[model samples]
Target: MSSAGSKPALVASSSAASKRQAANSPGGHVDKRGRTQSNDEDDDEGNDTQPVSTRAWLSPILPSRNELITSPDDLATLLATLPGAEARVPDPQLTITRARHSIDSLLDRSETEASITAALERFIEAVRERSTERSRYPIALLAALPGCGKTRMCLEVMDRIVPAFCSQRHIPSLCLFLNFNSDAASTWRSYEESARHPQHAIARRLLQSYYGGAEITTNRDISVNAALSLIRRTEARRQQVLEQRLHIFIAMDGATRLVGAHVAPQFQEPDHAGLSLEQANRRFWKQALTDLQVACRSFTTPTWMLVAGTMSSALKQAVTNSRFFVLPVPLSPLRAVYAARLLDIADPKAPSSRLLPWRVNSKLMARIDQAAGLPRTLLHIIDPTTFLDTRSSVSIDDATLERVVRDGVQGSIMQHDSDFLESEALLIYRKQAPVFHPDISRVERPTTAPANLVMAAMMSTLHKLQGPDPNKAFDLWQSWEAFCAIITNLRILSAIAAHPNSEYVQVTNLFPGSTSSRLPEFFVNASAWRDYSEDNPDRRNQPVDGRVCLTPAGYTGVDSWCTVYVKDNNGEYTPATLALQAKLDQVEDCVPLSTQIEYIEKAQLNCPSSTTIVALLTTARMDKFDPSDVPPNAFILPRQGYKEFVACFELIADNVWAYNPHLSSIPRLASQFYGKGTTLAQARAIAEVVNASQSLDPKKQFRTIRDLRTYLEKHARVPNSGFTIQSIPKDAVLGWPYADDLVMEDSSITR
Candidate 1:
């Protein structure tokens, strides 16, 4: 009996070992004895009795599957369970230290040197004065076009002047740099979260600035109240140093962002519907400004705020309304010498000899200054790595230099970098609009139209007129009349679009008075047309076609004029013949000299004796036309005359859309007219136009005009194929005398 019991025990031990091995294998099972069981045995056990659910093997310290968070609510619940998770506070000392370091870093990166020191000194002077009078804090507003180094100037002032002031006076001073671009509240909140021991945060940031090796710390959660408390503590400490008053220098960059955020609801709301994007942005800016104001006021420290940006009128108003002592300092472009020095510092790796070539040439340096007009822009254009080509032994040529300058300016304008183009276009439009309507002090803003569209339209009009094969040319008188009509129509449409609230009239009803009354003041003046008619009694009776009529001089009178009418692709009439007298240089093919001469001689023959016919030339110099090539009596009016005509148009268009509600649609219009498919072809065209206009070489302008003509031919619509003349009854005195004379001759023959 003992041997049999021993045998069963041995078998049971073997079975247990086998089960344990099976449990350790993949997809194996564990029995109640903590021994592994094979799949076959488990299946057999399942067949014999109900199968038990296996518990997942989990470590005691690890979270169970049920406790795993899958949703935001679950995560929140888990966070809530942690100690001090809800009331995580940021340390104030870290925030102030980081802000100071940021200002320092900006100063360190700046390439500006002695050139910006004047502006820095002014800021320093203002800060020092603030100590003398607690209520008389100087608010210096540094205004400049974008890329003019305003930010760099601010940084340099803070870094050099602030530290120097503190050391000179042996007094404690607080310098705070705020970028209104970032949300003030959220930034503070982030600082609060990231705040740790003040020493550690400061040391870490310093290390990161110096060596880029510091590990980033997590932001500590701090309440708004805690932040305020820190500000209050700093303020109290600042007040204690009354004998050596704590001079506060607060520099605010992009102040436009701050003031715009707090614009009132009335300013934002449109008459038709909810706020537009522009209005919405303004509202946001107004609110942001309010928040910034509140936060700044909360600090009891006597502060001298230095605000800088391209100050908009709205921002200017806000600043004035706030009762801040505004000391406006306008930043101008650096002198060529100063700019060249800056370039040297910006690119230390460049060969000193190679760089000297750019400085020695006064013309080249002047060109560079004109091209960039701003320090930051110049730096961007002449980036050391990209601008300098070490492999090429040849020095830069004038053409290459010219090309670079053109490219830089065009690129800035095309990119709307610093809002340069938009501001320029607006200025041009504003200046031109008031000449047409002297009573109108301000142009209505385009609500639907965009700025680019307006610019493109203006460019397109110029392109058409200046193109190789310009619109049809009528005789001088006829051409002038046609141009007037076209301009008037465009102005009316623009006016209506600009001011939606203004009264509307049909195109036919635009000029309710007589035709002569409808003409612009320049045209109505008899002296303006004295050369064309030469005091002829029957000037109005001149034939519309190239046929000469009997004037006071006679039927073949020398003073008689003939006009050639030309229409543009849009079927708009313009005085193309007015430009006929303009000199043609390499562009003779566009207007053959021989053909023009022949036409002029023919018109002279039909005119009375001593007519002294003249043709207006668009070329800058009349010398382009050889004296021997034309009749002795025929004179050529040079480009200066053409400019005068262009000036007239500019005056009429200035400020027409200054306040247009549809001003935003200009970009879209430009895109539609010049853009290729959905791409940015319009921007390229505009850049090319700007480049051509700024080019010192005249050949580039000619080429640009030719290219523009080709572009318009490919893209613009053809003129409509229809013609109808509508005539209204005119007074007998103003009517054509030739028609009356012909009627009398016919009647005499019948009698």
Candidate 2:
């Protein structure tokens, strides 16, 4: 449990500065950004302990079988003896919860725990063979949200599962763990230096440990060969070691540093020194990592590489663009039951030790659920310094627990906002003026939207809706209707909140809008029931469903115009100048839709943008709605035999921001919108893929788009859905009697 050298002065003091040390150092306090904060200026001059070697500090040697730390418990204990081990590894005393599946687990088990275990076993089998196929090697990227236990999972498999599997076959499994943010790796400027240097922080410890502290040299090839060579030489020493071959697993944590601004790039290649962080990342992944993986095949031993990092756009892009075969295993959030066990408030090992006030309490479960199944958030809530006295057996009331949980959730959200603000670099100008603003600089750019609070708000609403009281639970109609009413509002607000230039981004209502009433809260807030007038000159006189207005943080000038599309659609989607009409009652005729199209056509007049006007008509119930009655340039909701009104909000959410209107495929939209047996969970997956596809090249997306079209065409519901074109009256106007009162403004339900 101990290193040969003495500890550094970083965490040796009792002073306040010592407490601010980074999370990696023992006794170091983690800052709001999850980084260890240290005061390097304050040195512990009194310490006389011998300094640890550069190699040891940079790369800690992997623990061998001689240590007898084979189980997860043993590994956890060993980790605890190391500085900041608690921050890096999960406590073995707590139950290890399997991460949720990103895609529908019913269809794909590749991300499941069983799948990962099988993959690890396969790695061991590959190691046993003298000449294994390169594809047999496990090259995985364990991706997850911050605090979702990516590191813990890696350690568990490496330290416990892999070793156990290898032991049964009499094969030795060795792991060399590296953290990019470690003292050694952080100082590395270029990939070449990191890979080539004899004392390279990336792999020196791995070499020193396996070669018994021998001086390992690098060759003309990429530096991974040093470790690969060590494994190859193991065959010559097999008689002395008493093993057939070695299973070497290389795990790299904090890999996000390699791609993003986490590390200050010092390019060794002269031509690349001036490249941006993003460009540098792309090249590093496409070339450096690819070469490293390719070099792995040159060696004989079964060696797999597991790169772990927080899920981010930069990390995802790097992995996706890489030519290397890397299976990305994203960790899902913890379930409430598992989270409860972590808190020791439910399922205690001993019945006598279970606290009476908290043991399996429904209120406690509710409080834990507020964390949205994130273990880190739960840990924050249970942190004794912040929330509770875990040692206390005294009675704790529900109200106190509720407050603690609420505060923890809010704190997590605030931290997210703080991080977003620090990284955001755009100017927002609200759309207040009627005339199109000539200043192009004022236009708001598409940015990372703040989704934490929006999700938290949504979770809270869902919780209340499905609370203990049966009466509060939503019926089928209530669920779809309520969701449709406010989803657009939530989407727009979330986008504005994340925009760096938005003015007055604040949480006015915990639940921003409710669906109890007929009209959405957006219209109600403006004291109108049917529609609100947009400041844009072209649509100034037109009464629309609702509009979201956001001004730049410090300016009153308009930057972006987000016109809410509250109605239904046609084949192509041009989000700009689009209008949506929600039909709660049955659609008995096409007159209403015809009138709506005329109004939108009039609004499209003299439009400066190339984007065309589109309209979507949504209805929960429709009678005798003939395929021939549908209007051109318009789309009808619940196209015969489809009843997924609730899931369709995902489409609306994707297109809410009018600034970037990606003309998504109609077949793809329909596949997701009316795909039989689609659940809310599946809808979320579709939305994510749809959003991601927007950034990809059109040709690259052809496969996915074609697949979705195929699915839509083949589904049972497609047979009855007609596609005949119908033309509406050219003179149709917005003066239809029923349409006038379709959307009305009432302040009675205003908050």
Candidate 3:
């Protein structure tokens, strides 16, 4: 792709400055915060010739095909509006909408309590601290590849973070979270539009949840960039009180523009001179901090907040490390994690066999875990619930645990067929399937309507409403278009990996080369290309109108074929049937509860929530568990506050957090009482750091907080009023986690 002209963002460099440029340019480097480079990526060294757009490559990995109504049109609108001058119309068949949905689904399904709690703790500390020696970055960027738990982690964080202000009647403190979406990549909503505009929004209502009476300001003029501007400006008002103390945590999902955006605010654009395309598009992120400062200076008290965004590593690293903050959260023992959750959930029901850490027996499962490096994938992609259900009862036996590993791996593999089908279908839909495409007339087929009904319904809902996005109102990420694109794209990839001639598919015209072919081609080489014996003009490459077209096997009715027997056309359809039918001619009026629920949850976690979460929820008729019933930690309240008839209501907060105090975001006194083993580890790490930092004796300092404070005061600033008793990281000295991230040690790691 040619470098376009100047756009809105100011940060520069989509990837970090490194000798090893990230394999995925706009994502993160393999060695950075997001994305675990698959082995396949390493084996291929000369991939520079491929497309620069990660969306293009990753689009095919999704596995759905519901044609979203008006979604493509909305994307097209954005494409047209971005500052870059481009008549290069997006492929009408492009499933950008659905691609978004798929990503949201995968991310939403994989959240865990521990991951969520830790992120909140870290975020809260960032909000409270002002020191410079420590990394006091307000933007907590979590980047990862597909199936990684970054998005899930954000949800977990919101669970804690939102309540911070909510409990204080300052719920609107939650700021806007721009879903870093490709479809929306071209054009952005203004600060006001983003907060309450219909269509894939993620804030405002969240504020209402926390502030109770907070309403979407009817007179407000919020926009897409507003949240970012707010987050970037938050630091300026860190010490402000009242309205100022209310922070806006804008969780941007795909902050690919971080680098450029961050830099843009700092760029001194001559008042009369327009920024170059690069300056606006890529350089803005570096100045994001400045733009934010400029925008936020006018707020009442000034909103002190953070930008909690989910990005791929390449995208995350694009910003200059010296200018911004980045955090990499690696996957831990997932089996152990899942086992613990399952044990908790199971304990409430029946006698259960003790669940153990899931040790994989399958090479594929191990390979996958090693490649993705996240446990959420195992949970969602593998469908742990299904694995557990296979038992004679709900319990996971030793045999069941072993079997789960095998089944989960198989599930991941089975997904390829569907994955590829959706991918190729999207390619077909974009280039080969669009009725208006030059090649559309070449093949005489049934003409039902102008749009895919199911897709339309899905997209319509997504574009319908974005409430007070800042406040975590309905902070979900799934939308109709995003879901369709994700599922369809994934299906396409699955198909590509499974094709018999997968080796030669890429070079072939998108549609498989022959009618006899069961799968589409996957290779990108002419030398490896296999020619079809009986060439159908459509299947083989040919110039139609102007564009040369190859009908990829999964596209143009190949995968959209309806079953021979139609059960009923009354509009009621089974997913099995929908999966087999030709693409819908128009939007479906209703989506299933199960599908809608998934959509809402995903939307809650992605950018879609920014615009249309409430609509999505209303349309789906979805119900959120009472905040008190949700997992991890409930919003803590005095018993009198939560009185059920002043008698019947359960004290959910104590009930839930009591089970896993680790999940609580509030700094509970109990956490200070670490287990012996945990304490030992903590003490050891502290000792090492302190020893190195001060050359002090551990025994002497261990005697009293005063002695240690006196010793550290010589080299550090210890607050006079309060006494802190814990270890901390060197980074925490001025940045995050207040003083707790550091470990006091007789010998510190002189960071």
lDDT score, candidate 3, position 296 = 26
lDDT (10s digit) by residue, model 1, range 199-301:
2222222212211122223333222222222232333333444412454555566655443243332222122135454444334333223222322222233
Cα-based lDDT at residue 117, candidate 2: 70
Pairwise TM-score winner, candidates 1 and 3: 1
Per-model TM-score on C-alpha atoms = 0.37, 0.40, 0.27
Candidate 3 residue lDDT tens string, 341-459: 33223323332342321221122222222222233334432333422311111222222222222222222212322222221111011111111111101111132255332222222
- As a whole number from 0 to 100, the lDDT of residue 506 in candidate 2 is 25
Please report, in order, the local distance difference test score of every candidate based on alpha carbons.
Answer: 0.32, 0.35, 0.27
lDDT, residue 83, model 3? 43
Global local distance difference test of model 3 = 0.27
**RMSD in order of candidates:** 29.0, 20.9, 29.2
Residue 500 deviation, candidate 3, in Å? 24
Which residue segments of model 2 deviate by more than 4 Å?
Answer: 1-111, 124-132, 180-199, 204-239, 242-244, 261-267, 270-277, 283-295, 316-322, 335-367, 382-751
Q: What ranking emerges by lDDT with the best candidate at the front? A: 2, 1, 3
